[model samples]
Target: MENEKETPEERRERLRQEEWKGNPTGNLKDSTHRSSYGSLVDFVGGMGWKGTGMLIILIIVGFIIYFLFFS
Candidate 1:
């Protein structure tokens, strides 16, 4: 059997596919896999669309209350 060498791009694609398949080996760290959002965004995303809207509404209400009472 002939062993074929994979290019860096191919290797990254293969690893990304494996990660999507739920086989996280934890050997390689790919920048693309990292989220750009901070913990707050991650929390809001985890809550789904409806919860995200609700969170936004609550934040707006809180800001309004803060400005009216203190600022």
Candidate 2:
């Protein structure tokens, strides 16, 4: 009865909300991604190529520092 009374736009929005409720990917910051390396990959992917390159440079620098001081 309520569905029949709803306008087309309202029905469409309701359907979209229902679909979103069933979708696991609706929340990018959910614990599932944060529980694994997926979060790190997502972070790097969100950054452009330049940022990724910078991250690599930082990692290499970190490794070099560790080797120089600890190893």
Candidate 3:
């Protein structure tokens, strides 16, 4: 019996082929995977895009006021 030795590039190509067979996209997919971060984004997004934009702008203004005056 003989073992075939492959080069690094060949091994990488083989792994890529296997990965593409599973998920063509570069993103990994796991059935059990639920992101707390994405949930938070969704929660904030429920406030509506316009409201979210206003809230973000208010936060920036508040920070500028605090830093320039209070600090």
lDDT of 2 by residue, 1-71 (tens): 88889976567657767876787586444555566555664576567689999989999999999999997
Q: Pick the candidate with the highest lDDT.
A: 2
**Model 1 lDDT tens row, 1-71:** 22168755456556667786674444234323444333453465467789989988999999999999997
Give the TM-scores of the predictions, in the order they appear.
Answer: 0.44, 0.46, 0.40
- The whole-model lDDT of each prediction reads 0.64, 0.73, 0.63
Error of 2 at 49 (Å): 0.3
Q: Residue 4 of model 3: what lDDT? A: 59
**Clashes by residue pair, model 1:** none
Q: What are the C-alpha RMSDs, in order, of all predicted structures?
A: 11.3, 11.6, 14.3
Q: So what's the TM-score on candidate 1? A: 0.44
For model 2, the superposed segments whose C-alpha errors exceed 4 Å read: 1-38
The positional error of residue 18 in candidate 1, measured at the CA in angstroms, is: 4.1
The sequence of per-residue lDDT tens digits that candidate 3 reaches over residues 26-55 is 434422233523554445646767888899
Once model 1 is optimally superposed onto the true structure by TM-score, how far is the C-alpha of residue 23 displaced, in angstroms? Answer: 12
Better of 1 and 3 by TM-score: 1
